[model samples]
Target: MKIYFKTFIAIIFGVSLLGCDPAEKQNKNEEFPILGRKQFVERTVNGETVVDTIDHTIPDFRLVNQDSIWVTPKSFENKVYVADFFFTSCPTICPTMKKEMLRVYNAYKNNNSVAIISHTIDPKHDTVALLKDFAQRLDVEAPKWNFVTGNKEEIYELGQKGYMVTAMEDENEEGGYIHSGAFILVDKEKHVRGVYDGTNSNDVDRLIKDIDRLLATYNEPKTKS
Candidate 1:
C-alpha cells in the first residue's frame, strides 16, 4: 500500500520544471516490476560483477546523519542496506513511511549487517536536532539506522537524478513537495538489487528476503574505512 496525498499538483509542476519525460515517470499508481529474490550480477569498475543485482548502480553521494556526522557512499562499503526519503514535519505519507521503517528497524535490530538510511526532503527544516528527536519518537536505535540531512540541491539531485527516484517541490501548485516512499536495496558490490515500498509491508518483507539472498550470494564489496 502506498501513502496518499493532499495534493499532487505542485509535485507535477516540479516534475515539469525538471522536464520529466512522461514515458519514464512511474505510472499514476503502479509499482515498478521487481523480480523476487534473484542473484543477478552487477558490473563494476573493479572488473568484477557483484553477483545478485537488479535495477541501478551506486553513484558517489555525500550527506549528513541525524547526529550531523558527515556520511558518504563509502560509509556503507561492504554493507547491504535500505534507504528512503521523508521529512520530519510531513503530515501525509511520511508518517506511514516512518512507521513502516520502525517495523523494519525492530525486525532487523539484531542484524548488524543490515542498515537503514532516511533522508529528509526538507533539509532546512529537518535539522540534526529535529531528526534526532523524530527518531527518538519513533524509537529507532543508533548506528544501525541513520537519519540524514544535507544540502537541499544535492538531496534533490541524488533523489531525482542520481537514484532515479522521484522528488520535487512546487509552491505554485498543490503539495509543497513530493517524493516516493520506496526502500531501495543495494547489494554490497554497489548495485541496487531491489526497490521496495517502505509504505507497503509486503514489499518490505520481500525486501528482507532479497537482502538475505544478496548477502548469501555476494561477498561485501571492500572499501577503506
Candidate 2:
C-alpha cells in the first residue's frame, strides 16, 4: 500500500510542476507578442547603436506654416531637418534654444538639402499670424525654415508620439506647458538619427557632424567591386 501511494503522489507532483492550473498558462502565453520589424536605428543616450524598431515610415502631420501655407508630411519627405518643440511665449530656455537653432539655420541656410521645423506646443495662443511674427523675429526664411501651429491635441501628440519628445501642460508650473530643449536630427527617410541639446554647443557640434555624415551617405554613389 505504501509503494502504490508513493507512485501516485510522485505523478501528482510531476503534473503540478507542469501546470498547477492550465488556465493560467494559457493567459500568460497570450500576453507576449512577437517583435515585427527593425526599420530605424535606436541608439543609447550616449550615442551607441543598440536596438532598432521596425517601423521606419515617418509619422504624418499637418499644420500651417509661417507663410500661412498648409504644410504636411510630404513637405519634408525628401529632406533632413533638425526639429524642436517650443512655444513663442516661453521665457525660460526657449530664447537660448532659439539662439542655438539660429546657428544651425545660419549653417544650413544656403543648403537646400536640409530644413528646420520649429513646432509650437501651444497652438491655441500661437496662431498662424503669431507663428509668422515669431519666424520674422528669428529671421526664418520661407521654404527653408518653418514655424508651424495646428490643432492643440495634434501638436501635443506629435511631441509624445511622433518625435518622442516631451511637451505637456503643467498647471502647477509658471508656464502652462513644459518641453525638452533637445534638437532632433532626422534623416531624409524620416528616421530620427540623433537628439542633441539645443543649449549645448558641444552636442550641437556632434549633431552637425552626424548630419553631414548622413547626407554624405545618401549622396554617395555606390562603387562597383
Candidate 3:
C-alpha cells in the first residue's frame, strides 16, 4: 500500500507540472538579450554605495511620418516597434527588404501595441508626399507603419547611433545613399531586442518569432496555482 501511494503521489506531481500554462513555458524557454550600454548606478549594498550596469535604451527623435505628422519617441511610448532605413528610389535591396517588412506588417497590422517605422535615408527625394504614395502603393497605413523622412543628417545619426545600423551617402552605390538592410526590433522600454537581415526570409521569420517572444514579456502569464 505504501509503495502504491508513493507512486500515485509522484504521478500526480508530474501531471500537475505538465498542466502548467504553455505560454508560461514558452516564456521560460525563450530569452532575448537586451542589447545596449549598461550604466552603473549608486546603490546601497552591504551598507556601501555600489554601482551596477543597467540596460541601455534607444533615445528620442523628432521626425515626420508618412502623414507629415511630427513623430517623437513619445509616440511609441509603451509600444513594441520594428525600425528600418530605406529610400523610395533604391533599385536594389530596398524592394526585397520592404517585401520582408510586409510580412511583419501583415502579422501585426491590427495589433495596436505593435508598429513599424521605416525611415528614409534619402530624405531629399523621399518627401512626405512621396513617402505617403510609396506607403499607399505598398498597402501600409500610417501611425501603424510610418514611412518617415526628416533632416538627412539626423536620420543618418539615428541609423548609426540610435539603432546601430549603417546609413551614409555613397555615390558609387546604385542608390545615392547607403544604409543597412537590417530590421531592428525594439521593446516597449525602447531597448533594442533583436536585429535581423530584412532581405532574408528566414531571418525575417526569426524576427517575427522574436516579436512574439518580446510581446510575451509584456503579457501576464497564467499563474501556476
Candidate 4:
C-alpha cells in the first residue's frame, strides 16, 4: 500500500474546492478525512488475523512560546489545534498567513477546545521577545494562539516530518528562509485532518468551517460493543 501524503491530498483538496458546491460539499455530519500516510499492522485477535490502522500523528516537540512558556504536545492535550511555520521578519507570505490566521484566532478565540501554534523557522532571529511582540501586534495571545521559537533544526524537522510541510533556510529566497504557508488542522488526537493555504482567504474560510466539523466529531455518542 502506498502512503497518501500531503502533496497528494493538497492537490485533491484544491480540486474539490474548485469543483464542489459549498452548500452540498461538506455536510455538518461529515467527518474530515485524516490527512497522512496510514500504516497497517497485522495482529492476532482472538485467534484471528486482523489488520490495525495506525494514524499519522504530530510528534513530540519542546519549544518556547512567546510568554517564554515551554510548549509541548501536553500543552494542546485534548484540544484540536491549527499550526503553521513563520518568522517575524518574513517579507512575503508571512504577513498574509498571519492576517488569515487572525481570522481563525477570532473565530475560536473563546472556544477553549481550540488552539493555534506557529513555529518560527528562523529561531535565531525570532527570539521569545520578538515572538511576544509579534503576537501582541496581531492582537493574539497564548493558550489561544502561541508563537514559538526554539532549535532551528528541531523546528524544521517537525515542520517537514511531523506537520508534513516545508520549513528551511534559503539565502536565495526572500527573508533568508522558506516555509509552507499552509495552516494544518490537527484533531484532538494530533491527527492531521486538513491543510489549507494560509495565504488564501477562501481556503481559510473553508478551514474555519472544517474546524467546526472536526469539533463536532467529539460531541457524537460513543459506540459500545
Most accurate candidate by lDDT? 4
* Cα lDDT of model 3 by residue, 74-165, tens digit: 88878899999999999989999999999999999888999999999999899999999999999889889999989999999898988999
The TM-score that candidate 3 achieves is: 0.82
TM-score of each: 0.70, 0.74, 0.82, 0.85
Q: Which candidate number would show the highest TM-score if scored against the true structure?
A: 4
Candidate 4 off by > 4 Å: 1-31, 223-225
Candidate 1 per-residue lDDT over residues 1-225, each given as its tens digit:
133352476677887867756545643333423323344765666786566555456667888887777778777877877888888777678788877778778877998778888888888888999988988888775667889998898888887755567877756523477888888776666666677888888887887777777676555466534
Candidate 4 on 1-225: residue-level lDDT in tens? 145687788889998878777656566446568988899999999999999999998999999999999999999998999999999989999999999999999999899999999999988888999998988988889989999899989999999989999999999998998889999999999999999999999999999999988897799778743
Which residue pairs show collisions in model 3? Answer: none
Report every candidate's CA lDDT.
Answer: 0.75, 0.81, 0.91, 0.92
Instruction: State, as a TM-score between 0 and 1, how close model 4 is to the true structure.
Output: 0.85
- Residue-wise C-alpha lDDT for candidate 2, range 1-225, written one tens digit per residue: 999999999999998887866777775454312122346667786776687667534479988888999777788878888889998999888889899888888888888888989899888898888888888888778678889888888988887777778888987766788899989887777777777899898888877877777787777778843
Q: Provide the lowest-lDDT 10-residue window in model 4.
A: 22-31
Deviation from truth (RMSD, Å), model 3: 7.6
Clash count, predicted structure 2:
3
Candidates 2 and 3, the one with greater lDDT:
3
By TM-score, the candidates rank as 4, 3, 2, 1
Report backbone clashes per prediction.
Answer: 4, 3, 0, 0
